[model samples]
Target: MNRKVIITCALTGAGDTTGRSEHVPVTPQQIAESGIAAAKAGATVVHVHVRDPETGQGSRETAFYVEAVDRIRESGVDVIINTTAGMGGDLYLDPHDPTTFVEGTDLVSGVERLKHVEKVMPDICTLDCGSLNFGEGSLVYVSTPDMLREGAKRIQDLGVRCEMEIFDTGHLWFANTLVEEGLIDAPPLYQLCMDIPYGAPADSSLLASMVAQLPEGAHWASFALGRMQFPWVAQSVLLGGHVRVGLEDNLYLSKGVKATNAQLADRAKTIVEAMGSSVATPDEAREMLNLRPRS
Candidate 1:
């Protein structure tokens, strides 16, 4: 066997894709069920983000995470849980008034975003490296250096691994800074988010360059949006990193076909295996990422 690749299935995201695809999980029960289904389909980890049941928008509620995580644990499925601490940073400014915060803006302090992570204490939680133009609009996903340092310290104190989310090269630089400052624990993990609008483009050369910049002993994964999701699996593995896929970054298994979280994980498993790399089990993934032993 070549390398054992860990596959993470991101169940539901905070994107506006809920109406676009009926398969996007909206409620806490659905999120937990999707995670369980993905785990059974050979996913080593499940990245979770809760949505408001009434509005289907992403929420920062601690109770939602508590229930979702508890349900996953109660199901007895063996899979690592990775929750998103990237919420509460969405800032949508009015195009007319640049200084004014708009209705879509959800900006909050770095510590505020980790309320769910604090409550559930997942195996891993994401810490977006920096702010960036979030799409083809006035929305900017803000994560300042101060916010990052604070969040990194909080996550470090929790003993949960922080999976630094890298949207661009500059974000990668700041992530390395956090590592250098000793805020991040050993075996730092990175998630290279590609093709998400104004962030890093989905280019193999860029991915290679980014991987080369990772710190020694760092565990990493790369993912792209929509059509590139599965192809990037091969791209990430070839670069000696892991892989992530699911309804969060993508909504389809193929063109015009909506996908469930399980379907996406199964496809990723096939791609990783076809490349002569075996998929890591949950325990194997815990070892690879240096996660704290399950409590």
Candidate 2:
């Protein structure tokens, strides 16, 4: 395909992957540096998820966002900042009594989740479309209909482009509902996340089916976890969508070889170019996704 594909590098996620790889940036400074490197390596957008510096767990603190955004801006790299508003919804339930919340639970209202976004005012933000069993456990990532509506309205009000994260077909359905209800703006964005357990599996046909279900004029991207990350880059482009890659979804550039955020971004850029598609610049991405210019 001869198109300008926007490459997004997810710097760090909230998952407990710090123990698995030392490359996962835990502090705000590290996250900023990693994102800057990715941008330098050809990523147009950097998806951010700050972690607690002390504990290495995911944090929704505005201070973390402030520091990370500040550092990235101060570095003068032209990359779109896309922060995660998907935090504060993790609900690890008690195995015996599902009604009772467990130690890992961090459930909160959708409004609370956007507090960081409201403060930082990034170029783009994520809105997970619906609830799902996140992993192989009782941890249901809760984002109810009411919560989604409230979140979508708030993200719109903030003037941040909302990238609707679709982990399953139902999530995609509700995302369409949000768009139909006018909660989402024109050129709505979607991210098809696959193979996270108990949700949609990593299958190209399923991706095509979901792509067919998307609303008209919608811009979308798709990704699978772990080893499937690079392949999904080609898969997404072949299907006329963008691609995402980083340490957030996968830890290795190759088997038994660890990868950095910049390395993953470089590899993704090479893949996109090898497939006869040029990678979009930050400004081009902004234009294509209808995002506001970086301020």
Candidate 3:
């Protein structure tokens, strides 16, 4: 087992989880504070996503990202900032009229999606490898090959690390193809996203299989949503992969109890130490992931 594992804390995701958990940060200040807290709690990286402060709804605003990143930077937190470039791909098709797009659909081009990342130049940004049936009904997370190539190239050009997000086995194959095409840089970074509906389930067998499929010399982390968050932390380390934990993926520390991002990071750190693995610091994580420092 790899003793030096990096922990990434997903501070606030652009999901419908505000009302469900009060600890989910909504404003830029709150998000920055949560990120700093996670870093202090042993997370080497902070994966961030902004929301509409007033409504607590997910947004794709550059101003929100700028504010959040500024706050985190000003706070002098020694953690790698990993922004979300996975937005602007939601496609909710109409059930009755399949040809027509639904109201909540926010389909955007690849260039539009990377605007924030380009402007802020965060140390790392997410690039979802492939599309999948996001949830029940006609909802789908659309990430086409052309779009993926465009996003990957842009992130590479900006000199920011792209954290390839894989939700299923097919996604892993597609990511490997990117490496073959030279779109993804050497020593690729991957996040094995599990437990999402219609994606790879959060099971030890499945996690092991996914880990085995990763390209040689690739740095990777694995996380599960909701209740599986803590368990998957140990499971990932056991499988020779890193770990991620936060309110973005899971809201509860236990049954019917909500957890903040700092709490989640602390819990994951506890598990990693218990397994005889030491947590990687931000500088070590930057070197391992091949991320450039912000200017």
Q: How much lDDT does candidate 1 score?
A: 0.94
Against the reference, the lDDT scores of all candidates come to: 0.94, 0.94, 0.91
Off by over 4 Å in 1: none
lDDT of 1 by residue, 179-294 (tens): 99999999999999999889999999999999989999999999999999999999999989999999999999999989999999999999999999999998888888889998
The reply for model 2, stretches above 4 Å from the true place, is none
Off by over 4 Å in 3: none
Measured on C-alpha atoms, candidate 3 has an lDDT of 0.91
36-134, model 3: which lDDT tens digit per residue?
A: 999999999999999998899889999999999999989987888999998999999888988999888999987789999988889889999999999
Candidate 2 lDDT over 52-135, as tens digits, reads 999999998899999999899899888999999999998899989988998988889999999999888999999999999877
Lowest-sum lDDT 10-residue window in model 2: 286-295
* RMSD, one per candidate, in order: 1.0, 0.8, 0.9
